[model samples]
Target: MTTVELPADAMDPTRDDRKSAKIAAGRVRPEPGAREVGGFGLGREVLRSGQMLQAGVSGDRFSPEDRFCPVFFLDGERHKKARTAIARYFTPKAINTHHRLVMERTTERLLGRLRATGTARLDELSYELAVAVAAEIIGLTGSDQATMAGRIEASLFATRVGSRNKAVRFGVGLVSALHAGRFYLRDVRPAIRARRAERRDDVISHLIDESYPDRAILVECMTYAVAGMVTTREFIVMAAWHLFEDDALRARFVAADAADQTAILEEILRLEPVAAMLHRRAERDVAFTGAVAAAGDVLAINIRAANVDPAAVGACPHALDPDRGTKQKQVGSFLSFGDGSHRCPGAQVAMAESRIFLDGLFAVPGIRLERAPDLTWFDGLGSYELRHAVIACTPAPTAD
Candidate 1:
């Protein structure tokens, strides 16, 4: 180990590096005549930008200053109020209720198409399935769902890290897409308006009828709809592809009974966390593991790194071994959903929906990863799109 000595003035803590450290930890570093000590950097800019809205929530919580929407939307007394208002819609109970319908409908409809045609891009198909399920749950029409999905896809690529120079163009594209989506939303506004008039039994109708939630708050929930639909869709495809590509894993997965599903899901989440990193900004000074961070410093938690940390998981951290251990043993260490107060509110719903769809997939005979297409992974985008995934299903085996 190398020993380093600090300058005599270092204790003053007015230096820039110390300021950066303080900002990185979400705390205020001492600064003379400075409103804030932190300097702006790529991390801070990206973290504070509107981009995190598309990033999805984590399984764990960040500092209060680091929380992002809709988690970040509230503070103190109001936080409880907002959470209470939305809790019923997102809770495990509510999600479980929606599972059978969404799962069955999606699988039957999609698999029917897949079987009819022998092969297709499973990734795109999965995305469509998730969009349909989410739209239906949130009371959007088929066309509305398609439009939303298209726009979100474009927006995601547009906001991707390396594309900053094209941001304006991306912004215009996303805006145009969202405008089209708004037009679609507006087309149904009359229905929402009518529901407000007649009190129809629908989720959007409920939102419309409720006098408590403001229009902005209601619109913000649209992000939730988009997030739930898209992230889970990508996650499903990615997870399935991982299993299908590895024969041993798929066999292990198929052999596991219903009771084993939970463990399998956790292992999948652990091995392939959807969002590899989370971005946040410090609203105040904070400290973490000896790092002092100041206000306005951008903070990023390496989810992929943390999940695979040898010390955290113990033994063969790199492999995807669902049966490696029991489910109870891996809870917090698994950063799949995220951490802390800003953890994913839709995780249970996403997981249930994913498992159900996967079950249907495994049930299909001759479902295999056919046509090894060129594959590339993008960490920034948090997904991998296959050049092709040619799959064909055989007729179910005749009863012996």
Candidate 2:
């Protein structure tokens, strides 16, 4: 297998210079023939094709027996069945009817706290909001919002083991497993028991009605918690950072209604997707966009690059254009939540949470960035995280 040596900065999604340079090279060469690009390639065509399968079995980390194995890793009828069973919970109707109130309340509470404090870290506020919404949806009601958020954050560090030595990875995985077990015992198990005794409309209840084992239920909850909490938190911070830095965008977003806000958020996600790289493996020999892959080959789909591919997103793909006219003919289109069957079920939920949170955040007069945040990447997953996103806010005028 040939390897491609990408510059360190190429993996940092916020570093447009290096990322654009690397993407330019892919556009010119297209990774065809014997010049394979070490599993990392860009372009809409590469992602939409049927040659690749979810990268679940490509490594031992996601063995079939793993508790975290959800529909995301399954294929064919198995995947379809699992996704079908739970699809209703994430539909727009379900989100609006069941989860919307939770999101609004959580956002209001957090923003109120920020307004009172006058200075706060955006990441902390975002994380709290995300955890509250996700926890409620997953039926994790035993723990307070702050405690659940801390546990979820600690458990997510396991994802950082991607490139570590086997010994270190093993240690990290062990610690992560223990943390997850504790979270399940403390927060999830009680809810699971309650759901079993009397079913509800939440995800935990759904899992019980489906007859999932306790371990599997815990895994699924963990999966949704991390997916919902971490990604949404990062996107919230990133979107706010962009809006705060750009007065025109902020003005437009603040003035626009919820629907317009959704579009603006999609555009921001298109530019700065939280998970910039998605891994997939070939199930059999395949060729596309001049590149050929044998069975069992792993490919890293550069989501950030593909989202901005000129051929796909049209002129000035890098620019943050909420009104960027949709081109119907594009292949991959937007991959912020990925494409195809394994796409995130909580896409709508994440978007809703972001819109509600931002709506409340920007409504506070004098709310502005206290300092610029530093964006860092976890080499293990090609994902970005923000630090020190301090925001200064004054309490909104109290009603008479």
Candidate 3:
């Protein structure tokens, strides 16, 4: 193990400044260690090195069974096979063809309702859109949209059992288990039955065709549903908040075409990525920065810090610049999507959904935040939640 001494500036009062200071210092001595590596350059190197393995392989705190079979937890050959099988559904082309219309329609419906209602909670709308897209992709569209969305949210809430108090943790865990079981039985099991009997052009149908057991399919659905619903929901609100704060960026995003909107979406994701950190475990001895990581050592890649690393993004990395060129000659160099084999497979879907939703959202007249959202951070995996993100929209224009 190795430790790097921090300078006085590293003790800056603000959290963001302190993080930046640490990143600046780490760039000077990029080493593999238990402590977080901050800069995008350093973090990217660590992620792409192939020395680190998915942290979920060690055992997921939220669900221990994830280590065995979930796509998120598997490593090496198993991971490759599972990811490749499901990969086609998430491709840019596939999403555009099979699911893009679903996303667009969902966004239009939600935003249209918001425009009529005059005031709406952005987080709720985001969750609804995310659920609809995820559900449609997985062939779980039998349930009503709101009911399905609620079930997904409940399932996610059941996973947050990170409390210091033993009793509280135990109580939450028990409740979470019940909620998760209900979700599996009510929402997931029915979809599995339907898909198994009559396959469709969706992920569940693919799994059925492959003859995956109900338990395996349930786990996979849980993984995708929670990930798809929570991350995208948070990001949509975060991106909208950023746009609502800046007039120029908002105007540019509103007028940008799909190609440019994709770029803007990438940039927004870089600045306010939903995942604050990417966790990895060392597979063998590896030296990084000033530290030597031995086998089984866990490393937390500080995504927020790294995304703004000047070495990668270049000057004024902290500033939100949509046109910031890709770093190190790599497209989408930001670690918002992790690097290496474990990179998020649903990256394109999330980006496309966000772009489509924003297109519908900002299309309305006089769209503005009714109240600033209260941002809260939870313990498990550094999850960020937005509360009270009320937005006001004027009525849609009438046809001439």
Candidate 4:
């Protein structure tokens, strides 16, 4: 191996690479400079731009009173305050203290089921594990986790019955609402009631203490539901697919330390972010580097393209390199989780849970991918979902 020395500062994050990395025959070198804008410079520009309000989930369409929505959509001080109050649940100390055991036990149970069944859908198992772990963190322990998982998944990812017919559209909307309502009633309300009587260190409890109405609390629950459960589940299937398909890479990942395993996972996420495009609307005209957005102009931050931008990511932006982000002193997942004020607060939580669960998953003896998942585009969140990923493992020996 040859060592390539890099300058102290690189890429001049403000100065555009202009796709130079893509044109430079799969490699581009970085030069030292004031490059605080590390991952996806333009994406960072809009994300950090004080002039932009989140447009995802129609946040910009909400009136001021209705802005008490998900932290993902809140702007300015409200966003900051909400983020602060809810910060405790996602902090490193809190995750370790409150969530680690749940993640471990959930992983074990899921793996045990996989072993006993000999064959199972990786996506299904991942969904259950993701829901179980996230529900625990959100204080959503009010109902059967599996039932709740099914409800939320049905609400979010159920096939969008694409029809231009007004009547058909109404039916689809009604079904979706019913799914959402069931989740709220069966999962969110119970948690809220329980937390009301006795506060706890969880997202639901915090929202209740803040005097969030039941409707707002339900919205918040749905937000965490999608953010925590859906995204994590997809990532697990994606990571497992990559590992099971590559013998050498799988070996490296399986034998790696916790930090190394996480890096590998982040690298994969960089290549395949669950939310490929994050929408933001400009509250005022803003300019950064080579781009500008006017007030009320909707900006689609292309996370997928940004992740591969050669200028920020540096050389072979397409290849998997666990060390590249770290070598450049960048977050391993880059802008995969997002950037700036609205950056996903649960990044550390997601990374920890994913690493823990996947480590156990791949460690199963004779575990092998039996069928690949069907890939489908989901416009609801601007991402992809993988389903029907079947894997087989040696059945656990029966107790005599």
Maximum-TM-score candidate: 4
Please give the CA lDDT of all the candidate structures.
Answer: 0.55, 0.72, 0.74, 0.77
Model 3, 254-332: lDDT tens digits are: 8888977778778777766667777777889988775677888877788877877767876666555556654335455
TM-score for all models, in order of appearance: 0.70, 0.84, 0.85, 0.87
lDDT by residue (1-400, candidate 2, tens digit) is 1123234334334324122234334333211221223221343444555666676222444664553466567765666678898888788998889889988888778878777778899998888888888888788876777887888778876776564489988888899888898888888988888888888778899888777898888878877887888878888998888888777778888999987898888888877777666666677898876677788786666666677666666665666666653442432227878776777888988898899989988988789898877777644445677878999987666668
lDDT of 2 at 200: 79
Q: Which residue pairs does candidate 4 place in steric collision?
A: 9-31, 9-32, 9-33, 10-31, 10-32
Q: Between prediction 3 and prediction 4, which has the larger lDDT?
A: 4
**lDDT tens per residue, model 1, 134-246:** 66655655345566676656444533434445877676667656654564455345445555667633456556645424343344445565567766766676667666765
Query: Which lDDT value does model 1 have at 353?
Result: 72
Where does model 2 exceed 4 Å of error? 1-51, 56-59, 63-68, 161-167, 287-291, 325-333, 396-400
Residue 157 lDDT in candidate 1: 51
Worst 10 residues of 3 by lDDT: 11-20
lDDT for residue 338 in candidate 3, whole number 0-100: 88
What range of 10 consecutive residues in model 4 has the weakest lDDT sum? 27-36
* lDDT accuracy of residue 74 in candidate 3: 68
